[model samples]
Target: MEAKEIIEEKQELALALPLPSTIAVAINGKKKSKYVVRWALEKFVPEGLHMFKMLHVRPKITSVPTPMGNSIPLSQVRDDVAAAYLEEMGWQTSEMLLPYKTMFLHKKVQVDVVVIESDDVAKAIAEEIAKALSISLLLELHLVACFQGSAASYSHFHSPSLPMQRFQALSTINRTLLHTRTGSIETNSSRRQSLDIREEESFMSPCPSNSDIGYAPSQVSSARSFLTDDQSWISDQASTSDAFTESSSGSQVNINFELEKLRVELRHVRGIYAMAQSENIDAARKLNDLSKRRLEEADKLKEIKLKEEEARELARKEKEKYEAAKREAEYARECAEKEALQRKEAEIKALHDVKEKEKLENALVGPVQSYQEFTWEEIVSATSSFSENLQIGKGAHGTVYRCNLHHTTAAVKVLHSKEGHITKEFQQELDVLSKIRHPHLLLLLGACSDHGCLVYEYMENGSLEERLLQKYNTAPIPWFERYRIAWEVASTLVFLHNSKPKSIIHRDLKPANILLDHNLVSKIGDVGLSTMLNLDSSICNINTGPVGTLCYIDPEYQRTGLVSPKSDVYAFGMVVLQLLTAKPAIALAHLVETAVQDDQLMEILDPMAGQWPMKETKELALLGLGCLELRRRDRPDLKDEVLPALERLKDVADRSRDSAPKVQLAPPNHFVCPILKDVMHDPCVAADGYTYDRRAIEKWVEENDNSPMTNLALPNKNLIPNYTLLSAIMEWKSQSNQ
Candidate 1:
């Protein structure tokens, strides 16, 4: 069965809700925050008196780190200058409220400004600002008392309106708030209408819809008084009728009947009013339930929106990941392709290099190829099938064996196994080694074609690299010997570079390739990475590819991919520095340069290399730094500038070695002046009374009035002749064969 329900004259009334009493605005003392306050005022601020709470969330000040240095955030304001923190905040609040103060005063608004110093608000400052901009945190809603009513509506006050032309308002209200809160008998007469309203309605215009909603005891009492007054008036009418009834019967009867009808109609109206009020209570209950359901639906919609936003953010991240993955995949594929192409090109270049090496080796063979050749059977017999004990040394080129060949103790170098696959670098090394005849160059004796073995004269020592490091716990090389070794390497390099038709550039110039004999004489050993170029206008050997160790490679050659004689000079510079300091080659130039600039070069010298001669060592270091120039043109010419300097240093080292047994102290080192360190020509004394050269002391006094030896202030610029010291120096020089 279908059931039907109906509400009779119970439709919901369309009435305005209570206006918000407070609009809480959050400010950050920023210009954008003022825009937010202005927007709230223009948008939906109701047509009623309101209180705006200007809540400013002051940021907590602190220090943070940056690239340049540690810095404080916004360090403009000072506590002492601004009186105190509270007063400063007050000033800031006033500054922010400057724009809207006039408008707010005219409107029915009051402001209660406050500054809150809280870290939580500072942390979520962005969120708070957004909430304020959305007006979600600005306005706080409350169900205040029912809205004020006007004269035309169900009003209880009998207040009268003033004359329109005069436009005067006379209000005697206690101003506890904007509107009077207490005192029942308050008078307000305005030109338009009064804002004060009463809870109860007029008896003649009773709104039954609002009868049971928030009705107080006062309203009930007022209703009872109106009913009692009506009853009194009816009783007075009845008494008059009774008096009239004794005098005139006809008129009294008609009056009595009309009075009874009026009483009946009043009772009927009272019954309807009571029933309508009861129904209004039920309707208000139903409306409250509906409002709750609406709020729940709104909450559900907001949750769904949040979920959708999260999903969109996730999808966007996924798209970015996919794009990044695609790019990585493409890059990996390109790298694979490039690696394959490089491997192919390297193979082709290897084949071409082998052919060139073979042609050059054949051309240079002349009579060097006539050396005694050992058969494969003889080599196997001598080495005991290449026994492990017979092996003397192992290197990148091949293995060396101590074997007796042709009644001679020879070092036989054999190529690696399965490397009969003929290579380019080894052939070049063979061609150059077999033809060169320098005492500093390793001598090649013979070869075994079957296994690519070459016989060379045996040297008791290993290589320059091992000797410098003292790899087998050997004694450290003395400074004088290292100086001579540097000289030999330079002169030998000059020889190869000045070869007859074409010049040879040793691409690999490092310590490992230099060999040392029993006498500790160093020789350039490996010639594999070398290339011969035509002596043309071009300085660098640009015909061959660049290949060498990292630190020894010249900067210009590494940048432009060309090999030149100057490149060898650069490597020689690094070698010279290593000999002086005994440090690793990596960043050696930079370290030495910094030391020299700071005048700490003496501190960094190798303590193992027996007490270095100070003057010669400094000169060598300066020369090395000059040779290590970044540009090839800036470097010293190997033949002209460099060779002459090395020869001079070598002569000093040779004299020191040759005269080890002699006590040569005729002209002692102390005879020279402390400042200039030269034999004092015109010896003199200064105010500090130290004997010094006349010119050196005068220059020092001119720049600074201080003693050169003691660094103390001089009394006066005086040069007393030190004739006695001068006579000793002169007699000593003459006796020393000057």
Candidate 2:
């Protein structure tokens, strides 16, 4: 039959409109690519949606580049990544899609995922969906398509001049099932339904099912009518035969010959009837044979489709194996490269550290600032021979003691056995601390390097890290205090970077090294790990390897071992983030950046730091993130970009502190209601002359006729609003919020 040609003609006008319900989103096995699925779900899933399918198209790679500028076939590559996620070119479709599937399942949505390997992503997706639709519906759909063909075929059969009741009846049947190209074997339920309908039609018609060998009821009716007419004519002829009998004696002889002739014609008619019956039996046998052949062809078609599906699956598995092996080889090559790089870095670091002291000492002309070199006995007397009671703290280089030296309160750092790198650290710290003096830098009083001791003006409150961590139950630092500390640290770093003779890089700038006094004035300390470079506009000094706390280390310096003013900038950025959240320095920059990007800055602000101003806090977060650029060139200059912004925030913070209520977080005891034992929302003077919350006083008056404060019996239940107390309470809350 012309099934395919006829269907294609009809398809020309079928209008293949874009089906929003069947959304096709392009994605891949890359991190964050699931957002495409999310976008499809949010945008199209709500609009009368039916099926949501995810499509991933992997590329086919024959060969990959080698480290030596050579090429290797992908088949030769090793397989070490997860076998399940592997594709021919190392595409990780299933590994990436697991999360997406879980998300869709949670949303109560059904989805089909296609992982295809073809360079043409769009074409692959198109053909895959088409294949899926073709075999899914197994019904009389092809028959539907034929009905849509030329109407003239049916119109010719229905012509009034040439048609009888049967042609009109057959037109209602839409032609025989065998006329078409082919059909799928009917399901048992469908076959039974057809049989039931045929039986019902037989009951409605006068002819029995076996009686009509012809196609329709019209042929059977015509044959029955012709038989009745012929019988009536024969009866009329028999009644006229007796009247003609007397006219023929010779006619009788002719009648006998006519009888013989009639008998011969009957025998001929019998022979023709027998031949027709034999022909009918042959047609029935051929019909059964054709039916069996049709079934076998359908089974073959089904087998072919099944084999095609199996082939596709096999190809997918092979592709996955190839990709996994490719990745394994790539991973191995990367590891080798990394090992070589690390070995080189280690050799450089060892060479740099060995000559570090020499480079620094040679670069310096003797100490610029001079001070008394105290005798060993004097140091011993001041620190009580390094008594534990005198010892206030200890650090990486030394133990510190509170001492009275030269009639001034001082912090004396006694070197811990002064050996190896410890000696160099002490001398470098002493040289830098003695030469430069700033209000925001710890003041160096004197040093006796001979006895391994150095003294400095004492700071009462210890380091900023202690305050932030609330060590020893110390009260949390106020937000304004932290703001000023950030500003002070920035300004001090800039001063060191811009120092006249050379720039000093605080290789280890962290909260623990920042000291605060009784008034909470922050100062930078611990110049032991500090490195000074020769006068150069480049402001970068080559070092062996990165040095400092890993959490606050500059990422660039940690990688390349290049020291610059920007390295200090990177560390200072982390310090600022810690000040804002009171969080640990590790990953603080990432957290703040993400929070700022999501507009969730206020959520991470340290709530303990009373009422942080949102405008200043977000700006501080942004500034901190800007300082933490991974590349040194990308970081903002400490003197110009970071300090100016911090200075403005400091000024705003100062105003906020000034405008805030002086009573810390709570109101004065007079603002408290006697009945409620808490600050009154609305103060009212009771008859007993004590102010109470409006609701509290009313409730008390309802149950008790006496005052709650002095237990005095009330003569009258009259109460007056305490406007003066109410005003004070309102002012307190307003200032506290500001």
Candidate 3:
């Protein structure tokens, strides 16, 4: 059969079976005695045949007075009794089964005969009621006997043939015995009545005289022998008869009252014995009925248990099915997620390829002959999409990344394309950088206008500001090198301002814009703000405004909102001050001017630069001050004054060393102070006779007041200048600079 049909058939078969009846067994207030009774009933009663409810019986109190005058209220008495019973049974009295009382009245209570062990009064009352109702207890007992495997207990009472005849025989025996006893009592009473009547009749009628009867001694002797066993009773009776005869004047009276009295006592004894036998028969009948009910309950209980087991099995199977379906769903979800991830990766690659193709097409269509054009894909692949490791610098305008392209190293400046004005700036920078070419200026190798990126020759040493002020625990920038860098930047500025068609002013000029190559040569870069002036028109353009880094911006340009060559000079002056002081450009212009006016220029100089040429240092400082003048006309031009003056200082330093005696080039001796190993710097002799740089010795003495060479107290504690060694160092410095 199909599964569905099989299930239906099983259900139909289950319905055909009889449902077990529920039986409630009442326990009369005594819990300890009920345990054994409950156990036996439950064990022998099959679980599927019947279900048993164990109920505790509590007495219902009624308002009644005691034999004493005092009357206790029923509610109070009931509570007290309930509490005591609960204490004994270990139950809450409030939870007692109240319905059992009604069940008892309705004959729904299935109490066992075992209850007699705990409460005899209740058992006696129950048996009396059952007997009065003529309820057959034997049928119930027979059922219990079967379950208990003791059916033999009722064998004598049960008859195979003529089962109804046996009941009839019992009924007849009971009636006959009662009637025989009653008849005996009636006969005795009737004999007594007759005797009384006879006595009364004799008293009123004529009596027989003694002279009419002949005395027979032989008959009298025979009667006396027969009554010898009761001789004393007979003598008493005879004396009484003689007395009666004499008193009645020869009238004879005979009485046997003692014999009649003995007979009446015998009948009363027999009646009492018959009543006791009837009570025993009734008790046996109730016991039989109780056993029969227990057996029926056992059968019903067995059936119920079987049904419960089948239900549990069905539930377990359903749980396993649900878990299997859940696992399948989870597996399907994981597969879908993996597939989606693969599709997303494929889409990204396709997009990257499309952008690359578009850039190559644009390059081929509109190529700038001045420089090469790079595709965005080539740049991204080289720099790994501008990963943090390849990024060299970040700014408001753009990010600079170090990358390799076509076997050549390059710097990629990727401009911010979010703002509309930034595109104009990008084109302007590309225009300016592509046209200009100088050794001290950064070279633009290629441009990608579509992607807003500019490719240029990569500088190995980074920016001038980074080398001078950013590093720690490194040799300082020598005065000559600083002078060289300042001159190189000024020359680049001169070139930008002196171009043929129209001079370009580098609106933004600072140490950051000045980059350093592998050889530490200074290079000017970042011409995004450079604007070409119209030589034909003398008047300034109103569109041009004060736009440059703070502190580097000229005061005249800021106030007038005009672009001029002097504006670049003013910004270059700030860069010069930064080179000299090794401090940031912000507020350095005003601070330097104040120091120069106060004659504290030496105090503000970078000590790490070592001893400077005093006259040359003062001259450079004064030139920077002039460029920073508030009036644009007062500031010196880069081509005429700043560049020429810087070149003169470089020449003078070189000529002085050339005129001195030459010394063999070699590393400094081990005995020399490690701090003052540089050439042309101030050399001084301390108490330990160790030659150290003048500035280094002074700073050490000021901080520790001890000789660095010996790590001990100084005998002279003062540094005396070594003029001869200074002359030799100057010659060596000049050779190194060449």
Candidate 4:
């Protein structure tokens, strides 16, 4: 009763439990089974277990021979054979259990293999399929095969049951219990009657008749008899069998309850699977969308990089262009600067040339001309534009050039007149030279009025200062020639001072101003400091300031600023001292006067002036001393004392020259002076048919008023030029130099 009560409770519990909404049905492809599918469809699928997926695992197909004796491919054979077998096995087309491929409703859902047989190949294939699908593998028996399909075939297929399999087993067990209950009751009643008879025989006899034995045997046969006649044993056997039936019934009830619980759990699990599958699909979609966006972003980044590279390339090209343009501009600027510098240099050179030409022109022309005007151009052309080769001499005033004008050779004096005072002095010199004309004086040939220049008759022998002071490579002038030069210069001074209306005071009378002609005759030139004094009493007393060369300037004239004819006499005295000593005028001036006063005339005499007459030299020295007196009034008068004394000295020199024995080694006649019989530095011709030293003839002309050779009264004191003799002398000199 307890067992029945427990069974009733379990049956109630099974009815109360929820049913599974899904089940897995595995069919056997080898058996061509439709029963497995049908049984699952009728039993579990109809109970609203909608997740009924049929897993029909086909056997691996083997190569089969065709009618043509060619082998058919295994895959084609399996498809055709499987479909045909299922159809022959009475599988309805309308009851279409979805194919195995369609069973994968959720890719993530775990698959369980309900293997119908324990075939290793099938198990391996199922494992491989599980691995390929990335799902779990569960080896299981086909539960429906155990129930509906031939039980004899599945008799060895023992496996743990699923909820559906266990529920089917319980139903089979419940049906068997109905038939076995009547048998169990009949056995129980017979066992009880045997026990009552055994108890009544205990009071009767121990021994029995044949009828008694027969009754015992019938009762024993009525009881489900055992080998022993123990009453306890019969009762224990009946109770034991009853307990076994009750335990079996109880076990079936518990299994049914558990199966119903598993169904409910399976339903819940299915719902979970469905929800998980839906979420997985959404997540996959979102992941796909994100991948697309990433692709697009990558493409955009690639485009941006390309643009940046293009921009960089363009900038680089622009920079190169800018650099190229800069280089071009710099080159152009440098070229322009070089060109400008070249042009500026050209302009400066041109300006310098113009200035030099202008200077040359001014130096060749005189500012004031009282004679024939010669164009500066003609003078430049004549002197080859004052080439350095044509330059004969240079002085404080200007340079002298030997130029040939209109076939007449002359000395051109170009004055320096850059300063205003020097320019005025130039004009004054021109005026003075233009007015003065004497045989013992320089002759002005022509002039250029615009430029400060004077053209004079060229003197071949240079000056008395050059001959006396410069003793290089030349025979010294004899005492007679020295005397002759002194006499000529004295007479020239007389000529200047004793002019007609007014005496011309030559303030600067030095040896340099005393020039020599080709005949070595002294002629006064460069009267740049000469000024005229009127013979009238008022003008005769005029006091002019000191103006002369420093060493030759009279001491009294310098002190008192009194310039007179006596001033010329003082300068002439300095020149005489220079000729006696053959020294510079300034050097002699400092010591000569003191020497002469101390009676040291012979001590200071130039040894170059050979065979000097002591008496005559002393006389000349004393006369120079009188002229250099400190007071102008105490100075010797040129006409009364200086002139007459010089004339007597000239006569003495000539007589001495005549008395001197002729040396066999005398110079050639062309080189010798006709009067002095010395090598003439300055040779000039007289109208009386003689080429005499210029100083000798001028002195002779002044004192005797006639030529020495002819002893005739001359028509004019003008000397004719002896070019032939002069040329011969120059040629001889050049040969001698070589």
Candidate 5:
């Protein structure tokens, strides 16, 4: 059923109940509860403690209103906020009334709290007085009782017209206040109407319908009450007291006739009222328990707060200690840095003192050598007065010149206006290169730093990239030639990797640094970007700064800031893949369009080298893929991969040789063979005439050809016995004998 129907049915059930003399407490007044209780005790003595049972009879009101026309369900809002506040305060409390039923409707309602306990003695006495007045006036002042619906009807009237009008307007302002403030008036009006309907019906038909079929109504058809005591009814006042017995009518029946009639009904009313009052007392006891529990909880909460505050203070002290330690460390670091600066300054001064001593020594020694120096006239004659054609190049550091010095062809790098030695970087490069010698590396012939010049063996060919990538040159280095070039470059790296005083890592290995000889062989040209690792120290250790170009950088090294020989391996793999594909490293990325799944590897190989047997090629590609694995540990050692790859190439060559056709063989001799003796006189051995070649026929003829002239006549008889075997044997001999 819908909510309204369920509610109506519940109200109807309450209405049909046979309650004894009932007293209603209207929640519309401003009287204090304790004072009201005292008044109720004195006035409605019959109702007594049963007043508390009215807690169950909450009513639904439309709305509440304020005098200024503002409206709200103020009672409900208050209850909700109060509930939340109570919960926040850790109160173990429950609302006895539903939120919907606990509101009062009033045009100018200002409600704080509402309570409906069973009417006590004072209220019950007032109700009796009203009933007696009605009987005397012969005016039927209906005391509407029982539950009524929202709309006013004759049955169980709940609200008087004057209060309802005020409530309707008040509900427009505040709905909650209306229901809470006027709950009793609303309930009483509706309840009394319901009682009147039941009373009228009880007289008209004491027994409700029995069908013509003679079936009686069910026993539960009528409303029922629970009280069963009959002796509790008050006897007639005249019969109990003689003072009221003075009348000729013998006042036993007349003086308290009304009271005697009430005594019967009031017996049950008084019981219900007593029960309600007991409930109120129990509620007061429970409220006391709740307040006690709340006090205990508050003490516990205060202890927890004290502990939390103590923990926060401890944490603050620790933080302060940590800050102090951090500051002390920073001060210590500053002191150390200051000491280092002072030490470096001292070393610089000592070196300056040594330089002054060396200059004094050179001053004494060079005095005689100064006499052999060329005069301005001789210098002018040698250089043809600074000819423009002699200037070979200009740079940020200096000018380079092509010159014939002591009848030797050389390129001279001269500083533009040097009052000193070359730049520290240039001098460092010179020092390193002068000590090193390799056929493929640049050779430093001499240095004349006093004159700011460096003389070296000149390279006629430009960089390898210039030769390969130049547009006009159009030099198509064949795949084998490119492989040879890559091998030469790899050999150079291998030498560097194993160099003494430790291996030097080329931090920037690229095509631009690769120079080519006249034969197009690769030679590593630059040592400026090289780093020498200490041989005694761990190999392939990380350095602080990031090294290598974006395209050539190992992703693992980039992510982890670690450098290793494997990092070089990754870069070399990139260069190798680049050379193999004949594409620059930037373009090499395009080939790796997707992940290198085993099956898709062929797609990543150089498309220029038309499909070769890919089993080993794929294996090689996988080696490159391993170098590119995100983890540094998975990449193979360069020597391990290179040696196997060379072996694979050798195997490919061997297989190609085996697949070639064999030369034709000379015809075998039939005269010596018993199987072929009959055909010995044949001029040629052909496919149609020979039963088998010398290799197979010799065995066959030896077993079957048993004639006396076995050497001269091969077996000419047919092996299978046919219907015309003799003719076949004759034809075989004629064809074979030559």
Candidate 6:
């Protein structure tokens, strides 16, 4: 028969009026009544039947108990051995069977199956089965006493689709025992409520108690539903409380045939589970390694970028430094070129001056053959017809006259005697004087050979000595004019001393030869007694006859024939002293003679120069004495006497100008307020000693608090508000009140 037919037969038996623990069976139309008896003893009877005492008890287990004893029939031992084998395969057996019963009222049907379990678990099993079957009727559970022993009442059907439901139900039951109410397990009303009152024990162990259960022999031979080739037997076997329990020999035979089939299915499931787990592990490891490599690559990129930036920064700084150095080099080269240009210009100027001097000297020499000849006609023409008024002041040499030539005014000197040895020296004098044309020196325009004359520029004021001595009867020179004259004379002396190629010195530097222009610019006029300095030599010794005016002559140059620039400087100092004191250098001769004798120099100061600084005047007088020293070496040079004296005069002028009082006007009429007019016109305000009216201010202060109204006294006539005026008034009030 098929598995469906077998399942139908089992249900038909369960639905009978009553069911027994043991049943009689007939197979293949043979009257084998003993086979039923054997089936009862082999499959129906439970082990440990002697342990329970009930209404019916099994007298004893009469069969051979040892699984190794072959005396036990294969049919009786089959399920026991199978249970043992299942335990070795990691499954367990229950100690007891749970029983349940159900009645169909309309059909008057009673159904039951033996459930092996404890009393508390039997009620719960009955409820679970009733709910799954959608049964409304309450299940009635009963325990039965058989001839052999007391047996479980019945087993209820279980659903094959409830594996997940069963696990969740079991967890809820356990949680119920633990008193946790949050579980979501639900059951039909048919479930027994009494199970909640009776504390249920732990779930039963599925392992078999006896080893023989694992090694039992197979029964049912070719029972198509049991020892059959059909697929339904294995599935039907697992659907009920008896997952593989056999009700008869036919069922037992069916279970044995499907054992090998179930084994193959499980092995395939395990292989697939293991392969999936391995693949998951390998994928996880590769992902971790990839992540590590990516992190390292990112760091390397960052480091490279940082190094590139640093290199760029260094290159930029080097470029800036290079540019700066290049600019500095260019600047230095430009500076060097500028200095070279300046030096070249200075050299060119010096050469041009020397050339001009040579040209004038050649012009003045006027053919050396004519040194002894006197051409009166040519001299008259050169001197502009030698008119009577063309005569300037007469000198010891000859008549020195003014002339006009080439539209320029000039001075001419005509010698009285131009023959013999005197003629040769006179030509030398003319050559030397003509070559020197400095702003400080008198220029020799030309010589008059026919009239025995030389032409020179006319002096408008004649000489400084002549003007100062009142010889011209002109206006008296003011003090500032005199100081300026002094400065100009000193500057001229400095120019003469520093000329290149070293022009001659004027043996006479007296006031007579010191000529002034309209602006009072002085020049050293007559250079006839002059001698050209030898630039290459340290000293120039001239033993010629004395050629200078007696009063201004250097005593040493006369006594030792050592005429140097110092000899001229001494004569210049004497002239400066005469100018400063407004005294005649010749009159000072007597004073000098006395000073030289008495050495009481202070007594010699010129009375005309009143109230001069006595110390300065005395020192200057002493300097003049030193210039006229019996020994030439004792006198100060031009740089020491002239430059220092000029500097001192400038300092005095600066101090006097700085100290002079500044001009300020009186407060205007518009500034006069009606209230302040009384104080504004007060005598105190008008006095030079007071900056403002003191008496009116004093009267206002004496009034004390009444002065508050005095603010109205201030004039509103001022164009702008005078904060300074207000501040001064407030300060004055505060001081007076204190």
- lDDT of each structure? 0.64, 0.68, 0.62, 0.63, 0.47, 0.49
Those runs of model 4 whose alpha carbons end farther than 4 Å from true positions after fitting are 1-370, 537-546, 587-590, 661-738
Task: Please give, for residues 411-447, the per-residue lDDT of candidate 5 as tens digits.
Answer: 5555566533235535555655665666666556666
- The candidate that wins on lDDT is 2
Please report how far candidate 2 places residue 713 from its true position, in Å.
Answer: 50
- Residue 383 in model 1: lDDT: 81
Task: Return the lDDT, model 5, position 462.
Answer: 47
- TM-score of each model, paired residue for residue: 0.39, 0.41, 0.40, 0.40, 0.31, 0.36
Clashing pairs in 2: 78-325, 79-325, 88-319, 90-323
Please write out the lDDT profile of model 4 over residues 1-738, one tens digit for every residue. 533543453354445434333344455443334544443443333333445434544444345557898976655677777566545433432134334323333332233433322334344334443433211112224432233343344322222222222233333333344335555454433433443344323312332322232122112121111111222232333344345445556776545544543453454345335544654665687699899999999999999999999999999999999999999999999999999999999999999999878767766884433477899998889889999998988888789999999888899988877577667677677777677688888988888867878899988677777778653344456688788888888888888777777778888888778887655677888887777787663123335445668878777666666667877878888888888998877666668778877878788899867788989898988888788777777888877888889899999998987787532322454677867878776778777767887888888888887667667787778777677677767766664443
Q: What's model 2's overall lDDT?
A: 0.68
- Tell me the lDDT of model 5 at 86: 41
For model 3 the local lDDT of residue 321 reads 90
Q: Please list the residue runs of candidate 5 whose C-alpha ends up more than 4 Å from where it truly belongs after superposition.
A: 1-424, 447-460, 472-474, 539-544, 556-562, 587-590, 593-620, 643-738
RMSD of each: 27.5, 34.3, 29.5, 41.7, 34.9, 33.5
Clash totals in order: 0, 4, 27, 17, 64, 45
User: Which scores higher on TM-score, 1 or 6?
Assistant: 1
Model 3: per-residue Cα lDDT over 422-462, one tens digit each: 88888888988887788887999998878899998998668
Better of 4 and 6 by TM-score: 4
Q: Which ten residues in a row have the lowest lDDT in candidate 1?
A: 1-10
